[model samples]
Target: MCASPVKKNEPDNRKGQAGGDSGPASRSRTDRRNSQAAKPKREHVKKSARDAALSVLTGVEEAGSYSNLKLNQILREADLPRPDAALATEIVYGTIQRRNTIDYYLAKLVTKGLGKLQPWVRSLLRMSLYQLLYLERVPDHAVVSEAVNIAKRRGHQGISGMVNGVLRSAIRQRAELTLPQGMTDAERISLEHSHPEWLVRRWIKQYGAEACERICKANNEPPHVSIRANARRQHQDALLEQLRLGGFDAEPSALSPAGIVVSSGGNMALTPGFGQGDYSIQDESSMLVAEALQPEAGMTVLDCCAAPGGKTAHIAEKMDDTGTVWACDLHPHKKRLIDEQAQRLGLKSVRTLVKDARELAGEFEPASFDRILLDAPCSGFGVIRRKPDLKWGKREEDIAGIAAVQQSILEAVHGLLKPGGVLVYSTCTIERTENEDAVARFLEAHPEFVFDPIPTTGWPESAPLEQAASGMISIMPDRYGTDGFFIARIRRLA
Candidate 1:
C-alpha cells in the first residue's frame, strides 16, 4: 500500500520509452497519437467490468475509502449493465478478501516488488491474480488480457509491459507460487487465509492456534444473508411461509428466534416481502442483541450509537411497538436511516434523535430508562466476510483507539440506566480487550453496575453456549457460523 501515484508512473514510462518501445513500429504516427492520449490524464476510453473493479480497488487503497461505499458510488455513476455490475462487484470484494494471499503470490513473481509499482498497477496485478486463482468462471486468458489492456490504456507501454509480465509469470508459475516454506503457523495462516498477521497472531493468543485458524478460515467465506421477521406484519413462521410461497429457500435462524437464513433464491432485499416490510435484512448475530436486551411492552429503552437502526427496530418489534425506543446516533443524517426502517416496518414507537451517545446522559435525566442497549463501536473485525476492505484498512493501533470510545460510551450510559434496569453492551468484534476486558473495566469503575446473566431458559437449543464470563458472551465467527459478536448484560444495582 505505498503512496506511489501517477507522477511516479510518468518517470517510469519515460524510462520505458528510452529502453525499448516495442520496436520501430512503436515510433509510428498512430503510436505517437495513442501515447499522447494516454498521457497524464490516463482517461480510460472504455470502462470494462475489470476497469470498474480496478477503479474501486485503487480508490479504496489510495483514499482510504470503505469498499462498499466506494463500490456503491462507482456502480451508481458507471451504470454498467446488471451482469457487468455483478461481475465487478464479485471481483471487487474477492480481490480485497484475499489481498494478503495475492500479495504473497506477487512477492514470488514480481522482480520490482509490488510496493514499487504505481497504486493502480499494484491493484490491477492483485485483482487479476485473484480472478485467476479463485474465480473458476472467468477464463485465465481473459483475466490477463483485461489487466494488460487496462495497464496500457492508463500508462505507457512500459508499465503495461510490467503488468503483463507479472500476470503472465503468475499464470506460468502457478504451481510454484506455494506459501514460502518454514513460515510460522501464524504466518502461514495469515498468507493462506489472507488476514493481517497481527490480527491472526491476536486470535492465536486469545483463542489458541486451532480456533484462530478456524476463525480466519471462516472470515474468508461469503456470508449468508439473514433477515429479521417483522413481528407486527407477521409471525416468524408466517414470514417463513411467505418466503416459501415466494420461492425462497429459507429457514429459521439457529441463533436468533426472529432471524431467517436465506441461503438461496437471489437477493432477498429485492424480494416483495422486503418491499412490504415483512422482514428487515440483518445478520443472525446482530439479531441476537434485541432479544438479549429484553425490552418489555410500554418500557423506555435507549439504543446508544444506533445507526442504520437494525437493533433499534428489533427492539421496537420485541416490545410490540407499544413503547418508546429512543434510537440515537451522533450524525443527524443517520436519523433518516432510523426513520426509514421504522416507517418500512410500520413501527410508531421508535423515536429518532440526533445526539451523541457519550453526551446522552446530558440530554436526558439519569435513571430515566428501563432498558439501554449500548452496541458500542469497535474494530468491526467480526464482519470481514461482508466488508473485506476492513482487513487491510484496520491497523493494530485502531483497536485501542476504538476501545477507548467503547469504554467512554459504556461509562456515559451507566448512569442513564434506572436502578435494577438492564444495559446490554455489545460489539461486532472478537477482540477480548474490546469485549470482556472493556466490560470488566466498566464493572470495576462503576460501583452501581453489576453483572446480569442473560437467561438461557428460552435460548435456541441449536445455538449452544457454555456460560458468560463475567456475564458476557463471546460469539466468535467460527462458533455459530455467524458474524463474530460479543454481548454483555449489565444492570444498575442500587
Candidate 2:
C-alpha cells in the first residue's frame, strides 16, 4: 500500500521530436531545488517509556516481522486497549526509525560489538534505549520493569536479568557514551540515527552529508493518507466535500486534478467511499503516472507489469471503461489481482493475462496499441516511509540488476507497439541509473521511437516538467509532498 517515488530526466528533444537515433548526450544533473524545500522535520518527543517501546521492537526482531504490522496486530488482538496500543506503536516505530542512535548508546554498555550479539538480544537493547531517549510519556522505572518482565516471559530468567542490567546501566550513563572516533561523520550520524551505514553512504554520495541527514529524517516521518477520487465515479471536488462532511481533513491535491490528498481522518478501508468504489487510496505522485498515460475512450492500451492493477483500473476509468486494456503480469496471482480489482471497480474493458511482459511481443502485432504503460518492477527505494525495511534491505548492485530487467522488458514491449502508439515507461525509484539512465539508453537503441511531451490537457500547469526532457516527468519525495516516481512518454513513428 506504499506509494513509490520516481526521478526522471527525459532527453531534450528540441524541434518537437526525440533526438536523432542517438539519445541526447548525458543530461544528468543533481536536482537539489526540491531537496532544499522546507518542511517540518521528524524528531523524537522525549525519553522514558523507552522500555515499553523496546519490548514491542524486540518481539518484532525475534519474529522477523514488519514493525507496524506486528505492532498493530498485537494491539488489535491483545487485551490491551487503545492507550497501551498507541504507546506500544509509538515505541516500536520510533525505535526502528532511530535505530542507529539507540545502538550508539548501547555499544557503550556492552563490551562486544552490537552486531555480534544475538538478534533478539540486540533488538531488546535497541528497543529499551530508544524508549529511555525518545518517549518522555513513559517513565524509566516502568520501561525497565516491563522490558525485564517481557524478557523473562520470552526467555530464561537469566536473560531477563541481563536485560534489566543492560538497560539500567545505559540509562545511568547515556550522557557519557560516544561513537568510535574512526567512523566517518556520515556513518556516525547514520548509526546514531539507527539507519544502515550503506544507505547513508549512498545518500551522502548522491547528496552531501547534511542533505542525506535530512533525507534520512524524512524517512522516519509519519505518512499522510491520500487518495485518488475515482473520477470515473465522482470528481475530486465532490469527493473532498463528501470527505469533509464525514469529518476528515482532506483536500484536493495540487498536482493532480483528479487527486484528493487526505491529510488524516481514519483507516482507508473503513472510509465511507472505499467499499462504495468512490475513491481509491493512491498517493498523489502515483496518480501522476496514470495521468501521464492519458488513456482515451477507444484507444487500446497495455499495462505491462500491471499487478494489483492500480494503474490498470485508473486507465480503464480514464477511458470511460470503453477501450481494451491488456492487463498482464508475470505471475497468475498478480493477474488475478488485476482481475479482482477490475471486477470491484466495475471495469469491463480490462483483459487479464498471466504472461511475462518481456515476451508479450510475440503474441501481438508491432505498435498494436495507441497507449502502453510499463509500470516496471523496481527497487522500492522511493517508498521508505511506508516500507522502512527497504532502506536497510536495498543494495547498489540491486539497481544494476533491476535496470537490466527493466531495459530488456522495455525493449521487448516497445516492439509490440504500433508505429504511432505512445508508451509510458515508469518506476517508483529515485536512482538515476535505473531511471533517466535507463530511459536514455532505450532511446539510444530505438531509432523509430520519439519522445513526446506528456500532454497537459487534464493536468495542472504547476506540474510541468523541470528537467529538460520531452514527455518525461520525475517526481521526488524530497521535492514533492508524495512518493518518488519516474515517468516517460514516448511514441513510435508511423
Q: Report clash pairs, candidate 1.
A: none
- Residue 80 in model 1: shift from native, Å? 4.0
Question: What is the per-residue lDDT of model 2 for residues 182-232, given as tens digits with 9 covering 90 to 100?
Answer: 778677657655577876787688768886777676666656767787767
Residue 403 deviation, candidate 1, in Å? 1.7
Clashing residue pair totals per candidate (backbone < 3 A): 0, 22
**Cα distance off (Å), candidate 2, residue 320:** 0.9
Alpha-carbon RMSD to native, per candidate: 8.8, 13.6
Task: Please name the candidate that would achieve the greatest lDDT relative to the true structure.
Answer: 1
Alpha carbon lDDT of residue 15, candidate 2?
9
What is the per-residue lDDT of model 1 for residues 1-494, given as tens digits with 9 covering 90 to 100? 21111111100000000011111001122333334233323353556788778878887887777777777666656777767877787788878988988887788788878887767778889888888787766788998888888776666787777778888887787767676677897897898888999999999999899999999989876677788888877888888887788777899888887788876455565667777888888888888788778899999999988898889989999899997999999887788888988998899999999998889989899999999999988889998877888888889999989999988888787888899899999999889989999988998988788888775555678764455435677788887788999898888888
lDDT of every model, 2 decimals: 0.79, 0.69
Model 1 regions lying over 4 Å from their true place: 1-46, 468-470
